[model samples]
Target: MRVVMSVQIKKNASIFEMTREATPKEIDDCKLVYCGHGFFDEADIQNNINKNLMD
Candidate 1:
């Protein structure tokens, strides 16, 4: 039997606070920002990548 690790960020994460960047507007006031699940949905993934790379 093997045990697997599951990644989840749950409510109230402090990881971002340690970083320099202020909470982005996209994540609902930074409180519920990262839940460790799906940074972006399938639809917006391409757009975000393009914007970051192109612009």
Candidate 2:
């Protein structure tokens, strides 16, 4: 089996933090902000292509 991961970012006032799962609307908002620019999805992670964003 393979492990899949997701990321959620939250902002309060002027501070931004990585928290937990967000609502569908939040995800949609992110999609708009980060339209392109080579973002990875669940399938990309599973296939082991460009998986390391920190690299």
Candidate 3:
């Protein structure tokens, strides 16, 4: 999955102004992630998104 977002700086803070899913082509070309010693998958991504949204 990919996300298109607009960030803003206000009072020395960064705020996410907008966010949307990115296209397959965009994800393929621009996706960047460093799993390091951890395992990552679609379920991990979905879980993280859900957790953040709840907070």
Please provide, for model 2 over 1-55, each residue's C-alpha lDDT reduced to its tens digit, 9 standing for 90 to 100. 2222443543321111223344578658754222122334556443443222222
Best by TM-score: 3
* TM-scores for every candidate against the unseen true structure: 0.26, 0.27, 0.28
Off by over 4 Å in 3: 1-41
Summed backbone clashes in each candidate are 0, 0, 0
After the best TM-score superposition of candidate 3, give how far the Cα of residue 49 lies from its true spot, in angstroms.
0.1
Model 3, position 39: C-alpha lDDT score: 28
**Model 1 ranges with Cα > 4 A deviation:** 1-41
**Candidate 1 lowest-lDDT run of ten:** 13-22
- Against the true structure, whose lDDT is highest? 3
- The predicted structure with the larger lDDT, 2 or 3, is 3
Task: Report the CA-based lDDT of candidate 1 relative to the real structure.
Answer: 0.38
Error of 3 at 42 (Å): 0.4
* Cα misplacement distance, residue 27 of candidate 2 (Å): 0.4
